[model samples]
Target: MKVELVQLAGRDGDTAHNLARALEAIAACAADTDLVVFPETHLMGFPTRDTIAALAEPLDGPTLQAIAQAARAHDIAIAIGMAERDGEHYYNTTVLMTPQGIALRYRKTHLWASDKGIFTAGDRYATALWKGVRVGMLICFDIEFPESARALGQLGAELIIVTNGNMDPYGPTHRTAIMARAMENQAFAVMVNRVGTGDDGLVFAGGSAVVDPFGNLLCEAGREACRQVMVLDFDRLQAARNDYRYLDERRLTLPGERIEHADGRRELMIPQDSF
Candidate 1:
């Protein structure tokens, strides 16, 4: 799988500008790229109480419709975050969008500072099949918790995607957390963070990166606006999982089974033992 990480700053509450940049990035992605990811709230930016009502949009709103259109136009899967307005409540959400449509959606489960009163937390983690790979998403502060990535792992995620908005003094924190999350789950991890300063004067950290299953950093961005791409080999996944499997050892001996469908589909099937 080939993925591109977009590290750039977004004007807070400016959907028009951000969406334009996002669409442009999607359109410019390499022809062979399978996915393109952006930072947290890349669409709506950081919505304050005063602007939340105007900036937040429902999943089916024009913003997503535009993004879906971009995904279709580019023939690439796009992973990004936004301020999702769901009826009377709002969520910090991320989604995986394929050419067909939305492949996966995950609301931020653990709200960070300022997110507490503005957004409702998501209760569960989920993954979806994207080009034969099981993909899951996390937001800015979500990767800090081990359980966040673990939940996706249990749901059969082989690739973990994170849309981050981490700022000054905390860049190193997520830098370490992303690698830890992938290593612990024995899955590939990718994180895209925002750069430059925000409306509130908070400087976003732009250390976007990609980590392999064995916790090695394949590529990492500096604290600047940039676009980076990496090719992931599925063979590396098997090489890492061929030994002691973390998914099986972390829980009951359900005897995990890996399936490779002739058409290129791959899956890790483990019987559920409800925790």
Candidate 2:
């Protein structure tokens, strides 16, 4: 499938402007592209502790509705990040909208630093089927955890999209993590991060990229705001999985089981349950 990564800078506290920018980025891609991805919290930038709630919107809010309309008009699927509100709680969420309407919504499960106080953690992971390809959805820090990507891999996901708002001092770490997730899962991983500065004084690192199952970088962007399109080879992904067979080789154990070594090292065991 043809995927487009939109790397852009968002104006802090300006949802409307950010939405417009996202729409424009989508419009700039080829009409036949199957999907487009945006950075985390693309609607109002990465919110601060005090501004997160103020910018939070319902799942069916106008911002998402507008994006859905655009997806229909463009004949493509769009995945974007935003602050989601469900009654009294707010979440760092990513909504995937298809030409038909909203297909899947994934809330960030691993809260980063101040985010724990501003947004509630999501308890579940989500995946969607786009033209026969099982696409997993994750937000920002969630991809940093191997279990998050492995869970999706266990669910039969062939590709994972990470909507991130990764910022200063840790750009290299985030990029390496994205590549590692792909290599370890034997699946394709697409990471889209925002650029420029935010209200929290953090300058977002814009190294948006697409990594193949073999940990090869298909395409990547620098720190500047730009649009990147890359073709994902399903055959290559399948070939790598068939050759490496990491998923099939993984050992499973009980939920609370632990393996203790004579060297004083302990490891949590994975349950022997196959999805």
Candidate 3:
């Protein structure tokens, strides 16, 4: 599958401008690409509490409708992030729109920084089949937790897409974490992060990239507004899985006893006889 990652700088509190930028990027995507992914909150830059509430829109809002129209016109699947409004509550959501229409909507499960107070956490993880590939969806901080990627891998997701708004001083860390997730899960991982600074003065590091199951970086973008297209090799993915068998050999339960730590002290809890 050929996927395009759009790394762009979003305008703070300007949904209209940001939406236009996103559409322009989508339109500029290479032909024959199966999917295109944009950074988190692509509709509007990550904002303050008041700005978030003000800019949040319903699922059927105009921003998404416009994106869906573009997806249909381009005949490609597009995944982009936005602030979703559902009555009084708002969520950091990623909407995956296919050529037909909206295919999947995933809310950010793990809130980061100010998001904890501005948005409600999502309750479920979602996956969809696109172009014969089992694709899993996750937002920014969700990929930081190993369990998020592992859960999707267990659910038979061969490709995991992370829509992020990660910023400076921690961009390298997030990039390493993404590669680790791909290696451990034996799945292709793609992360699309934004660039430039936000209203809060947070400088986003746009190191958007695609990694193979073997942790090889297929392509990576620097801290600039750009787009990258790469082909995912199913053969390489299968070869990596066959060579490591990490997922197949994983043991969900620890044998005998489990370790515990608290207040700098460690203890072992014995398992029941049923074990």
Best by lDDT: 1
Residue ranges of candidate 3 with Cα displaced over 4 Å: 253-275
Highest TM-score against the true fold, candidate: 1
Q: TM-score, each model?
A: 0.91, 0.90, 0.89
lDDT of each: 0.87, 0.84, 0.83
> Can you write out model 1's per-residue Cα lDDT over 100-216, one digit (the tens) per residue?
887878888788988978888875576788888888888989999987788778767899999999999999999999999999889999999999999889998899999999989
**Model 3: per-residue Cα lDDT over 1-275, one tens digit each:** 98999998988889999999988988888779899999998896676777777899998988899998999899999999998999888899998899877767788878897797888887666566787787888888888888778767766778899999998888988889899999988899999999998887889999999999988888889999988989888887789877567777988932333222231211222234522
Please give, for residues 1-275, the per-residue lDDT of candidate 2 as tens digits: 99999998998789999999988888887978999999998987767777877888998889888998899889999999999989998899898889877777788878899587888887666566778887888888887888988877766678899998898888998889999999988899999998998876888999999999998888889999998989988998778977558888889622434444442223333344522
Q: How many residue-pair clashes does candidate 3 contain?
A: 0
Error (Å) of candidate 2 at residue 101 is 1.2
- For model 2, the superposed segments whose C-alpha errors exceed 4 Å read 253-275
Ranking by lDDT: 1, 2, 3
